[model samples]
Target: MFSIFKTFFWLGWISFGGPAAHIGYFRHTFVDKLGWLDDQEYAQLVALSQFLPGPGSSQVGFAIGYQRQGLLGAILAFIGFTLPSVLIMLCLALLSHKFNQSPLFEGVVHGLKLLAVVVVADATWGMYKSFCKQKLTSGLCLLTAAALLLIPSISTQIILLLFAALIGCKYLASNQSNTHQRFTPSIWPLITFGLLIFALPLMTSGLPLIKLFSDFFQAGSLVFGGGHVVLPLLQNIVGEQISQDAFLTGYAAAQAVPGPMFTFATYIGYQLIPQAPIAGALVATLGVFLPGFLLLLGVLKHWQHLAHVPKVSGALNGVNAAVVGLLLSALYQPVFTSAVLNPSDLVFVLVGFYLLKQLQLPIISIVISFILLGVASNWIV
Candidate 1:
C-alpha cells in the first residue's frame, strides 16, 4: 500500500496535460516499467473508465490499485494521485487575493489554456483511430460530433447517446458471443449507487456537507465525457456561490495541475467554505469520485462477459465512438473558444499542436515553452 501510494503520489505531482496524458503516463509507468498490468488489462480499465463518468483517468488509476491490493489500495491511489492538485487548488483558493491580479500568473493560465486545446486535439485523433476504426463506428463518431456541435446542450448529448445505443443494438450487435470467465458481480454496489442518487437529494437540507455532496455527486453521476465536461456542470453549481472570475480561475488552474481535473472541486470547495476548507475539499472531492468507483466495483467482475455479449458490446462501441465526438466538440467550444483569443494565441496553439502530434515533445516541455512564450508576449507587448 505504501508503495502504491508513493508511486501515484509522485505521478500526482508531475502528471500534467490532463487525463489523456495521465493515462499515457500510467501506461508507461505501470504497464511498461513496473509490469503491474498488461497492456490488455490496462486497456480494459481505460475502456471502463471512458464508458462511465467521473474523472475517467482517475477511475482507471483507482481500478488498477484495486486490482493490485483491494479497496484500501484504491483509496490510497485516489489520495496519492489527487493530493498534490488538491493542495494546490486549496492554496489557490486561499491566496486568490494575492494572485488574482498577477500578470505572470495570468500568463501561465493562458498558456495552459492553449495547451488544453492541443491536448484535446491529440486525444481526439488517438481515440478516433482506436475506437472509431470500423466504418459504422467512425460514422457514429462523426454524427455524434455534428449533433453535439449543432445542438450544444446536455439534453442533446443524452439523447444522442440513447439513440446511438439503440442503433448499435439493432445493427452492430452480433448473434455469436465470445467466451469469458464466469464471475457474478455484486448487487450491493449498484444498490448503493441508486440509493445515493435518490437519497442525496432528500438529505441535502439536513447538513451543509450533505448538500455539497449531493451537488458534486450528481455532477459525477451525470458527466459522461470526462474532465472538461465537468466544467459546465460545476460552473452551473458553483457559479451560484463564487464570482465568475473565481470560478474561471479554478478551472484554468485545474488544467495546469498535475492530477485529476476534478480537483477543480477542491478549489471551489475551499472558496465556498473558507472557514473549514479542508472539510469542504474532502466532501466535495469524495462525492464527485464516489459514484464512478461504486460503478466500477459493481461492474468490473462482470465486464469480460459483458464485453463479449454482442448487444452490450455493440452499444459500448457506439458509446466509445460518441466519446470521441464529445471530446471533439469540447475541444472546440470551451477550450478553443475560451483560449486562442488572438492571432498570436493561434500561433501558439498551432505550434503546440504540431509539437504534440508531430514532433512528439514531452507535454511538460510543451507546457514550459508555452508558459515562457505567454510571459514573454505579455511583457514585450
Candidate 2:
C-alpha cells in the first residue's frame, strides 16, 4: 500500500500531457518497469476502465492498484495519483494571475496542446490495434467515429445509453449457446453512492456544500470517455457560479502540467473560493473523480462473477470501441480547435505526430520542443 501510494504520488507530480500521455507513462512504469501486471491483464484493465465512467487515466490508475492489492490498493492508488495535481493546482490558483501572464507559461501550454493531440492519436491507434481487429468491430469503430464527428454536441451519456441498449438487444436476439454466464447487475453501491452525493449539498452549508458535494460526486460518478468529456458536465455544474476566465485558464493550465487532467477541478475549486482552498480543491478533485472510484470498487468486488457473463463482456467490448471513437472526436473539437490556429501551429502538430507515431520519440521531449518553439515564436512574431 505504501509503495502504491508512493508510486502514484510520483506519477501525479510528473505525469503530464493528458490521458493518452498518462497511459503511456503507466505502460512504461507499471507494465515495463514494475512488472505489476502482464500485458494482457493491463489491456483488459484499460478496456474495462474505458467502458466505465469518469477520467479514463485515473480509472486506469485505480484499476492498476486493484489488480495488485485489491480494493484498499485501489483507494491508495487514486489518492496517490490525485494528490499532486490537487496541490499544484491549488498553488497555481493562488498564483493564477501571474501564471497567466508569464511567457514561459504560455509556451508550455501551447506545447502541451500539441502534445495532447499526439497523445490522443496514439491512444486511438493503440486501442484500435488491440480491440478493433475484427471486421465487425472495425466497421463499428468507423461508424461510431462518423457519428461523433457529425454530432459533436451530443452528450456522451446519450451515446453510451444507445450502445448499451443495442448490446442488450443483441444479446437477447442471439440464440447461440455459450459457456459464459449472465452477469447480474449490482445496484447497491451505485444506488448508495448516488444518494450520498445528491444529499451532500443538504448536509452542509456555504462553500463547503458546493466543494464537498462537487468533488465527492464527481469522483464517485462513473463517467467514461476521457478528461475532455468531463468538461461539459463540470462546466454545466460550476460555470455560472464561478469566473469563466479563471475556470478556463485553470483548465488550459492543466494541459501544461503533469498527471490527470481531472485535477483541473482542484484549480477551479480553489480559485472559486480561495478562503477554503484546500476544501475547495478537495471537493472539486473528488467530485470529478468519485464516480469512477465507486464504480471500480463495485466492479472489482464482483468481477469474478461479472467476467463470466458473455453479454456483459460483449457490451463492454462495444463500449470500448466507442471510447476509442470518443477520443478521436476529442482530438478534433477541443484539442485541434485550440491547438492548430495557424500555419505554424499546423507545422508543430504534424511534427509532433510524426515523432510519436513514426520515430517513437518520447512524448515529454515533444512537449518540451513545442514549448520552446512557442516561446521563441512569441519573441520573434
Candidate 3:
C-alpha cells in the first residue's frame, strides 16, 4: 500500500501534459519498467477509463492500483497521484492576487507541451496498432478519428462508441463462448453513486459547500472526452458564483500543472470557501473524483472475465478501436496543435520521439531534455 502511494505520488509530481500523455507515462512505467501489467491489461484499463467519466487518466491510475492491491491501494493511488496538482492549484488560488506567469516559466510550459505531443503521439500510434488490426476494427479506428476531427463534442464521442459497439456485435463478435472466471460484481457502488447524484442537488440549498460539491460532481459525471472537455461545463456551473477572471486563472493553472487537470476543482473549492478553504478544496476534489471511482468499483471486480464473454469481447473490441481513435483525435487537436506552433517546435517533438522510441530512454530523461530546450530557447531569444 505504501509503495503504491509512493510510486503514484512520484508520478503525480512529474506527469505533465494531460490525460493522454499521462497514459503514455503510465504505460512506460507500469507496463514496461515494473512489469506490473502487460500491454493488454493496460489497454483494458485504458478502455475502461474511456467508458467511465471523471478524470480519465486518474481513474486509470486508480484502477491500476486496485488491480495491484485492492480498494485501499486505489484510494492511496488517487490521493498520491492527485496531491501534487491539488497543492499547486490550492497555492494558485491563494496567490491569485498576483497570478501573472513569468516569461521563463511560460517557456518551460511551452517545452512541456511539446513533450506532451511526443508522448501522446506515441501512445496513440501504439494503441492504434494494437487495437485496430482487423479490417472492420481498422476502419472503425480511422472513421472514428475522422468523425471526431469533424465533430468534436462529448455527444459525438459517446455516439461513436455506441456505434462501434453495435458494429462489433454484428460483425466482430466470435462464435465460441468462454468464461475465464466467474466473479460477481458488487452492486452497492452503483447504488451509492445513484443515490448521491440524486441527493446532492437537494442538499445544496442548505450549505454552500454542498452546492460547490454538487456542481463539481455534476461536471465530473457528465464529462465524456476526458479532462479538457470538463472546462466548459465547470464554467457554466460556477460562472455565476465566481468571477470569470478567477475561473480563467484556475483554468490556466490546471493547464500549467502536472498530473490531473481535474484538480481545477481544488482551486475552485478553495475559492468558494473563505472561512474553511482547505476543507472546501478537499470536499470539491472528492466530489469531482467520487463518481468515476464508484462506477469503476462497480465494474472492475468482474471486468477481466466480463471481457472474456463472447458478446462482451466483441463489444470490447469495438470499444477498444474507438478508444484508439478518440486518443488519436486528442493527440492531434489539443496535444499537437496546442504544442507544435512552428518548425522548431516540430523538431523538438521529433527528437523527443526518437529518444523515447528507438533509444528506449528513461521518460525522466525526456522530461529534463524538453525542459532544458524550453529554458535554452528563452535565453537564446
Candidate 4:
C-alpha cells in the first residue's frame, strides 16, 4: 500500500500532458521498469478505460494498482495519483487571481505539452509494435487512425472500436477449445453505480452538498471521452452557479496542473461551497472519480477471464489495435497540434523524442530539461 501510494503520489506531481501522456508514462514506468504487467495486459487495461465513462488515465492507474494489490491498492492508486491535482485545483479555487493566462504559467504549460507529444509518440510506436503485427490488425490500426483523424468524437471512437471488434470476431479469432468454466464477478460495484445515479438526483433538491455530489457524479458517469470531454459537461452542471469566466479559469488551471485533469471538479466544488471549501473539494473529487473506479471493479475481473476464450481474445486483440490508433490520432490532434506550433517547437519535439527513444534518458531528466528550456525561451522572448 505504501509503495502504491508513494509511487503514484510522486507521479501525481510530474504527470503532465493529460490522459494520453499518462498512458505513455505508465507503460514506461510500470511495464518497462517495474515489470508489473506485460504489454498485452497493459493494452487491455487501456482499451477498457476508453470504453468506460470517466477519466481514462485514472481508471488505468487504478486498474494497475488493483492488479498489483487488489482493492486497497486501487483506492491508494486513485488517491495518490489524483491528490496532487486535486490540491492544485483547490488552491487555484481559493486564490483570488487565476494565473492561467500569466506568462510563467504559459511557459510551464507549454513545456509540459511538448513533453506530452514526446511521451505519446513513444507510447503509440511502442504499442503499435506489440499490438499491430499482422496485416489485418495493422490495417485496422491505420484505418481507425485515419477515420478518427478525419472525424473525432467520443461516439466516433466507440463506434470504431465496436466495428473493430466485429472485424476481430470474423477474421482474427484463433482456433482453440470452446470449453470454458463459468466465472461470476462481484456485482456490488455495478449495483452501487446504478444506485448513485438514480438516488443522488432524488436526494439533491434541498441540500447543497448533495447537489454538488450529484452533479459531479452524473458528469463522471456520463462523460465517455477523456478529461477534455468532461469540461463541457461540468460547464453545464455549473450553469449560473459560477461565473463563466471563473469556470473557464478552472478549465485552464486544470490543464496546467500535473495530475488527472478531472480534478477540475475540485475547483468547481470549492467555488460552489466556499464556506466548507475543503469538504467540498473532497466530496466533489470523490464523487467525480468514484463511479469510474466502481465500474472498473465491476467489470475488470470478468474482462480478465473473458480474455482467455478464443473468440473473445480475438475481439480484445482488435480492441487493443484500435487502442493504438486512438493513441495515434490523439498524439497528433491534441498532443501534437496543440504543442508544436512553429519550427522551434517542432525542433524541440524532435530532439525530445530522440533523447527519450534513442538515447534513453530518464523521463524525469527529460521533463526537467523541457521545463528549463520552455522557461528560458519564455524569458528570452
Candidate 5:
C-alpha cells in the first residue's frame, strides 16, 4: 500500500498532456510495466471512467489502485495523484501575475499544448484499434464521430444518455420472449444521490456555495471529453469575476504541474478567496472531484448487472467511440489553433508526435525535449 501510494504520488506530479495522455502513461506504467492489469480489463476501466464524471485519468488511477489493494489503495491512489496538482495550483494562484508575463513560461505552455494534441491523437487511434473490431461498434464510432463533428450545440452527456437508453430498450425488448427473469435493480438510490448533489450547494452560502456548486457541478453534471474540456466550463463560470489573465496563467501553470487537470479549480478557488487559501483550494478540489467518486461508486455497484445485457454493452461501445471522435474534434480547436503559430512551432509539433508515435518515447522525455527546444528558440531569436 505504501509503495502504491509512493508510485501514485510520483505519477501525479509527472503526468501531463491531459487525460488521454495520462491514460497512455497509466497503461505504460501499470499495465505494460507492472503487469497489474491486462489490456481488456484496462480498457473496461477506461470505458467505465469515461461514463462517470470528473477527470477520467484520476478515476482510472483510483480504479487501478482499487484493483491492486482494495479501498485503502484507492484512497491512497487518489491522494497521491491529487496532492501535487493541489499544491502547485495553490502556489501558482499566489504568483499569478509574475508567471503570466514570463516568455519562457508561455513558450513551454505552447510546446506542451502541441504535445497534448499529438498525445490525444495517438491514444484515440490505440483505443479505436482495440475496441472498434465489431461492425456495429465501428459503425457506432463513425456515426458518433460524424454527429459530434457536425452538431456543435449538442453536449456529450445527452448523446451518451440517449445511447444508453437505446441500449436498455433494446435489451428489454429482446428479453421479452425469454422466461428467465433478469432482475432490474431499483434506481432510487442513484436518483436520490443525484438530487442530493445538485441540491447541496443551494443550502450553502457565500464562498461555500460557490465552491460547492462549482465542484458539485463539475463532478456531477458536466461531461464533455475529459480534464481538458473542464477548462472552458470553468473559465466561463469563474471568468465572469476573475481576471482573464489570471485564469489563463493559472491554466498554463496547470499544464506544468502534475495530477488531474481538475486541480486547476484549486488555483481558481484560491485566487477567488485568497484570505482562506486552504479552505478555498480544498472546496474547489473536492467540488470538482466529488461527483466523480460518487458516480464511480454507483456504477461499480451496478456495472456487473448492466454488463450482462448485450444491448447495454453495445451502447457503451458506441459511446466510447463517440468520446474518441469528440477528442478528435477538439484537436483542431484550441490545441492546434493556439499551438501552431509559427513554422518552428509546427516543426516542434511534428517532432513531438514522431517521438511519441514512432519512437514510443516516454511523455517526460517528450516534455523535456520540447521545453529545451522552446528555451533554445527563445534564446536564438
Candidate 6:
C-alpha cells in the first residue's frame, strides 16, 4: 500500500499535459522501469479506459493499482495520484489573482506542454510498432488519424473507434483459439454503478452536500474524452450556482496543476462551499472520480478475459490503433500547434525528442531542462 501510494503520489505531482501524456509517463515508469506489465497489457488498459466514460488516465492508474494490489491498492492509487492536483487546483481557486501575471509560471506550463509532445510522440511510435504491426492494422491507424484530423470532435473520435472495431471484428480476427477460462466479475460493482447513476439524480435536490456530490458524479459519469471535455460540462452544470468567473478560474487552475484534470472539481467544490472547504473539496473530488473507479472495477476482470479471445482481441487491436491515432491528433493540434509557435520552440522540441529517444535522458532531467528553456525563451523573445 505504501509503495503504491508513494509511486502514484509522485506521479500525480508531475503528470502534466493531460491524459495522453499521462499514458506515456505511466508506460515509462510502470511498464519500462518497473516491469510490472508489458506493452500489451498496458495497451489493453488504455483502450478500455477510452471506451469507458470517465477520466481515461485516472482509470488507467486505477487499473494499474488494481493489477498490483487489488481494491485497496486501486483506492490508494486514485487518492495518491489525484491528491496533488486536487490541492493545487483548490489553492488556485482561492488565489486566482496571484497566478494571473507570472511569466515564470506560464513558462513552466508551456514547457510541460512541450514535454507532452515528446512523450506522446514516443508513445505513439512504440504503440504503432506493437499494435500496428500488420498491414490492416497500420492502415486503420493511419486512416483513423486522417479521419480525425479532417473532422476533429468527440463524436468523430467515438465513431472512429466504433468503425475501427467493426473492421477489426470482420477482418482482423484469426482462427486461432486457445483454451482460456473466462473470469467472472462481481455483479455488485456494476449494480453499485447503476444505483449511483439512478440514485444520485434523486439526491440532487436535497442538502448542499448531496447536491454537490450529485452534480460532480453526473459530470464524471457523462463526460467523454476527459481533460478539456470536462470544462464545458462543469461550466454548464455549475454555471447557475457559481459565478462564471469562479468556474473559469477553476478550469484554468486545472490546466496548470498536475495529475488528472478532473481535479478541477476540487476547485469548484471549494468555491461552492467555502465554509467547509476541505469537506467540500474531498466530497467533490471523490464524487467526480468514483464512477470511473467503479466502472474500471466492473469491467477490468472481464475485459482481461475477453482480450485474449481471437475475435474480441481483434476488436481491441483496432481500438488500440485508434487510441494511438487519437494521441497523434492530440499531439499535433493541441500540443504542437498550440505550444510550438516559433522556430525556437520547434528547435527545443526536436532537441528534447532526441534526448528522450536517442540519448534517453531521465524524464525529470528533461522536464527541468524544458522548464529552464521555457523561462529563458520568455526572456529571449
TM-score of 1: 0.76
**In candidate 4, what are the lDDT values of residues 284-361, reduced to their tens digit?**
988898888888898897776677778888898898999999999989988899888878888899999999988999
Can you give the TM-score per candidate against the true fold?
A: 0.76, 0.77, 0.94, 0.97, 0.77, 0.95
State the lDDT at 89 in candidate 5.
83
Model 4, 314: alpha-carbon shift in Å?
0.4
The RMSD of every model to the true structure, in order and in angstroms, is 4.3, 4.4, 2.0, 1.4, 4.7, 1.6
Candidate 6 local lDDT, 197-314, one digit each (tens): 8886786665888888888888898878887888877787776878787777678778777899899888888878878887888888888888888888887867767777888878
**Model 4 residue pairs with clashes:** none
- Pitting candidate 4 against candidate 5, the one with the higher TM-score is 4
Please tell me which predicted candidate would have the highest lDDT against the true structure. 4
TM-score of 4: 0.97
- List residue ranges in candidate 1 displaced over 4 A: 1-53, 64-73, 174-176, 180-184, 194-261, 271-275, 357-359
> In terms of TM-score, which candidate is strongest?
4
The segments of candidate 5 whose C-alpha lies over 4 angstroms from its true place after superposition are 152-157, 160-258, 342-346, 353-363
Model 3 lDDT tens row, 1-381: 799999999899878888978998788778878989987788888888877887889999999999999999999999999999998888888888564477777778888889889888888888877888899899999889999999988888889988998898777787776866776877999998898899868887868888888888888888777788878888887767789888998988898889999999898888788789999999889998899899989999888888887777788788889888888888898889988888888999999999999998987888899999987876676
How many clashes show up in model 4? 0
Estimate the lDDT of model 1: 0.79
Misplaced by over 4 Å in model 6 are: 178-180, 204-206
Clashing pairs in 6: none
- Whole-model lDDT values for every prediction: 0.79, 0.69, 0.86, 0.88, 0.68, 0.84
lDDT tens readout by residue for model 5, 1-381: 898899889887666566756776677678666888876577667777865666778888888887789778888999998998898788777766666557786666656666666666666676678766767556666666666557744365456546734753453222323333354544654675667566665656665546545554644357445666778778766756778877887887776665687888788778666577678778777777766765665556445466556565555555555555555555555456656777887887777778977888876788788777766776666
